[model samples]
Target: MAKKQSNYAYIGIAFSLLVFGIIFIPKIVDRVKVGDITRNESRSKKVLTNSDPVVADLMYLEINGVPKKVPPFSFVNQDGDVITNKDYEGKVYLVEFFFTTCGSICPRMNRNLVQIQNTFSDAEDFGVASFTINPEYDTQKVLKAYADNYRMTNPNWHLMTGDKEAIYALANIGFNIYAGENPNVEDGFEHSGNFALIDKNGFMRSRQDDFGNPKIFYKGIISEEEKEDEDGETQEISMLKADIAKLLKEDLVK
Candidate 1:
């Protein structure tokens, strides 16, 4: 009788542990999922609590006041040709700063940029530019390899690399985005993965945090407009296309 009781006690403890595992395992997994979503959302909003003030200030630039010119930059493309400001003249360029080996936000930003490229496929005036902050490591060959991995063979998408100081300076001062080498770490540079939209007139129109919300991703480009009645109000409501159309229409009037 005592022997039977001991066997039953052992069975009960094993059953209890099994039941607890079954109940808690999924909760742990769900918590991890929620944490990932929260992190991604924070990145998308560009709300890096740990980031420096210079980084935050650079992410949001004013549009109407003093005109901000994207300082001239010279970088080699994947094809090894020299690319400069003149290369993007009279075009709408979507600019993003990233390092190829970044494991966190770079892939998300690249995917969103690819979506934008597909959306504006027929628009010849639109282009995308990605600048690598880690110039020392991200040589033309490495950038070419990265571009090939993404299958980004489109002429409109340019992956550029130049001197490390020049790229970092452009990110901090010219583009108003924070980018620098990690002081404590070697090789890689830390940068916010925000996309900047530059209009044909050489104005920085919008800066989008790529990992934030899907709405922020498409907020940059100009969209086409359907003609309205004599009232002059817009008929179709495409915010991105409408903005672009408005800019183009204003240019035509000028």
Candidate 2:
């Protein structure tokens, strides 16, 4: 009986220590000054991370510096309507890829997107398009449910999926984002977190080539304070939101 009582006492002490550590470890961590840490300009200036100049497929017609045209294809959206590149004409859209079951960066990316949608809820010409990398599982029903789960009711925001081959081709050969099955990757599929911004004329907003030619989708800007959660968006996303407004204004003027 005494031994069992002593064992209980030990357990109680251990639990108390755990609780105490949980209460103060973060405070200790906050005060542990390793040294004077020099931070690079806290503001991330127009740093386009993935935007690069490149051309593949001979049909790669470009305009004013970004890939102006994309391979024609049709995909079903959450509303079950077939959306083709033609639907994107005269509109500016942000496109990206993610699986419904993604447990990593997708959540963060999607959260950023949610803020973006809210930021420009009244804009008719701006849209957000998301493609399911795991089309096999992300069926129309699943996509709709996922969008609904996030309160994504904007008619312009479309979640899509179609022929696996066509989608993969569009991800790789079209958007320049590598989308395919990779046994080495945690999700069994590899893709970029970068979003492609397509402009009103179907040309992707992009950087110019050496001699002045469209080459690739404009790279997004990212900064060091990107991890703040209160703003509900990353620094890069903030930059994107600003750029989207710039493009929308440009469209209105042109």
Candidate 3:
């Protein structure tokens, strides 16, 4: 009876092994074949072979069912070169309104922009179009000095200065990014501390807000390191960086 019990135990062990092999063997093989069995296995290999890499798409700002684009305007850059919307064709860039002599927010805004310039230091098709609100004082020379002081190394960065009215119109009417003069303000001028992202096609592009509306302009007043401001508005520098990367990648496919 003891010998028969030992035989029964052997059969039970073999039966369990067969059942395990039937149930789990294909899954183990599949995991190994897909490189999921090893923790150190390269994920890029699987992405390249089996799936499309994930990429985010930016939204086109629209008005009356038509996409808004960067308006056609020419202004002189820091290097005294004519820069227009055409100049930025086939490139991803940011647009901002600022003045060199600003005692308040311009410094912070440009500092944030400089951080972005450094982040995309290697991207050739990335650029910046900085329009000076105080064109009388911020000539090519002043803009050049400002660029130098900030170490603005991006070759495509253009600190522009032109007709004061034209600049104001471009700010207030064209891009709808507010810029105006105010004697009461410490800087003697007041402008929105925002940045607009433009795609290679000259269309102004941006990501949507939580409610699915285009954010339109990114907040340049807040630094990337800061998560939110005193008003509780979330910092968008990181979001801007991500969007810029997405636009640059879009250029790659075309």
Q: Which candidate is the best by lDDT?
A: 3
How does residue 106 of candidate 2 score in lDDT? 77
Question: Who is ahead in TM-score, 1 or 3?
Answer: 3
Ranking by lDDT: 3, 2, 1
lDDT of each: 0.67, 0.71, 0.90
Error of 3 at 155 (Å): 0.8
- Which residue pairs collide, candidate 2? 65-214, 66-214, 68-203
lDDT of each residue in 1-254, candidate 3, tens digit only: 99999999999999999999999999999888886777435786666645553434788899998999888899999999998888888889999999999988899999999999999999999999999999999999999999999999899999999999999999998999999999998989999999999988888889988899899999999896878888998889998999999988764223
The superposed Cα distance between candidate 3 and the true structure at residue 89, in angstroms, equals 0.5
Query: What range of 10 consecutive residues in model 1 has the weakest lDDT sum?
Result: 213-222
Candidate scoring better on lDDT of 1 and 2: 2
Distance from true location, Cα of 59 in model 3, Å? 0.9
lDDT by residue for model 1 over 1-254, one digit each (tens)? 99999999999999999999999888878887777445555664576643423211122245454557678888998889898987877677677888888877687667656655676677777787899987777899999999888877568688999888888888888887778877675445677655666666666653234564122223221222333434563332244444444343323111
RMSD (Cα, Å) of candidate 3? 7.0
Which candidate tops TM-score? 3
Q: Is candidate 1 or candidate 2 better by TM-score?
A: 2
> Per the 3 Å backbone cut-off, how many clashing residue pairs does candidate 1 have?
5
Better of 2 and 3 by lDDT: 3
Off by over 4 Å in 1: 1-64, 183-187, 207-254
